[model samples]
Target: MVTLVYLSVIILAWFATAANADIQVVCANKSVSITWEISADLVPYAARLFLGSCMPSHLNLLPSGKGEVQFNYGFENCKFKKQIKGKQMSYQNEITFRPYPKSKPAAFVYPIKCVYRSPANLNNQFLNPGSVSEGRGSLVFHMALLNEQLTGLATTNVIPLGSFMPIWAQVEQKSHQPLLLLMEECVAAHTPQLHSGSWVYPIINNKGCLLESKQGNSIFLPRYHSSALILYLQSFRLGHEGEVYIHCKLTAWDPDVLDESNKVCHYVKETERWSLLDDPFQSSICNCCDSTCKSRSKRQAEQESRGLRHNFVLGPLIVVEPDSPAK
Candidate 1:
């Protein structure tokens, strides 16, 4: 009776130690890889792989020995390839992994480019906003700043004092991998005495304004698509009698960074900054207008005499003027 009881206990323990299937999906560069591992004891008699809604035989599982089995599939052989063959596909896709009756199906989402066009121009969308369009290689970027009246928006080189300005960005990507877009007010306020403290950092409305993410976290440009972001801005003082600059950059996401929350974007060569009060667009900002506006050619000479200078790179410059009193 004791021997029979011990044998029953051993049989239950062996069954509990049975093997299972594990799967992982990784997307990098312009490719997506699906990898899976199955323990020897749990090798399936038959297996099937489905990319999106299409189950191509090219990725069908093959017979394996009773040890460990592994398989990998590339994006070209997967759903994207089916897309090239004139098959109807959805913008959002999923990869399904299943092995006979022993395991449950595991699915991973895939992002596909649905529409590839420039977002509607914010200047045309907003009232009295300034607009400027810039490009590098195949990629293009644009920015628009709120005009003095606050009813419209456009791109401008000068930022006034004591005024509220709203800025918007537009980007078009021609790359295979997703691109990261970063817009920053690159003024260093801590710089000593040359009026560096006059400029205010932009407040981004990642929720309603930017189409990137609802959580205000990731700002990615989908492959072969264009996107836009709205920048929250306020200028308490003019950083200088000269121009302020706003910088825009695009890069590929880095996976090696341990902190997933940190926005780790590697800079590409196409980075550009929008200039304020730059050549052809010049203005003197003050709460009470005193000094006459100088041309771009003469402003440098005047700045030297005024003894006001900045040692940091000027980004998108906002010329702020005093607000009208409550009527």
Candidate 2:
């Protein structure tokens, strides 16, 4: 890597002259490299080549769920880099530039992005306290402990045989007793055609007495897990007013150091169903589009041919529930 960088320096120092040729490209995984590619005649001046690196543009993920991203390989200002050795001229036959920042760690920051919120958007199908039956659909929840000492990790709580499962699997096994559920809805004022900007976080709506569960406790008695959650959001919108869509977006990272090779690390498991902390398309996000960051015409057609991706899309995954719970 040092050799390529040094060689790039030589190319920039003595030989290359800034010409009319358009020059630029957006390399993946941060880091933009800009170098002037000169014809064979400028080889001697290429010895003076110097490289200038731009400060990387940093992007953060939104929400607090855990995730991991590894920077594989990337380079900026690639089209103009010259690779040669001892006057051994390689070809316009093909150009191969060295990939950089091989295996290095980044800071302890999470890859979180901010979700944009707009007051004018809402989902028409949603309802509230003033609406019809179903009691306006309230949510009551608690983290219950069956036999606090009878851990899901242990055998006494099971049927003698054992396999693999999460520490919270017991909560799922005994779906009765003290139950936990979270409810949320989105609303818009005049959500015309629901143009990708209609969504909201899961709001709280508790009813009756709430249930509570904690670790290292006894199972016979349940705690009064308390919350004053209700759906009196006058600003909330209805779901069915326009088109409704749910897309996924995750931002995860820890305090661990990231190396160049550290592409994915310390991912926060999608263990619990985390409520939405932010909506995906409240503002413009770079979902997909051909970028004009390059000067070459070859890449132009590639950017223009984007399909529906030109419009913002929630990440490709989401959990779906029915209008009413199972009858």
Q: List candidate 1 segments past 4 Å from native.
A: 1-130, 147-152, 155-162, 174-180, 188-226, 238-243, 247-327
**Candidate lDDT (C-alpha), each:** 0.35, 0.21
TM values, all candidates = 0.29, 0.16
Candidate 2, residues 1-327, lDDT tens digits: the string is 897776566445422333342234333222333333334433333322222211222222324431111121122121112212222211111122222242532211111111212111111111222211111112211121122232222222221111211111111112223222212111223322344564543221111110110111101111111010111111112343322222111111111311111111110112111111111111011111112111213432342242100111211111123232321
TM-score of 2: 0.16
Candidate 1 per-residue lDDT, tens place, 15-91, comes to: 45423334455555434555444334333322444554334323333366433223233332233421111122213
lDDT of model 1 at position 267: 12
Give candidate 2's error at residue 113 in angstroms. Answer: 9.2
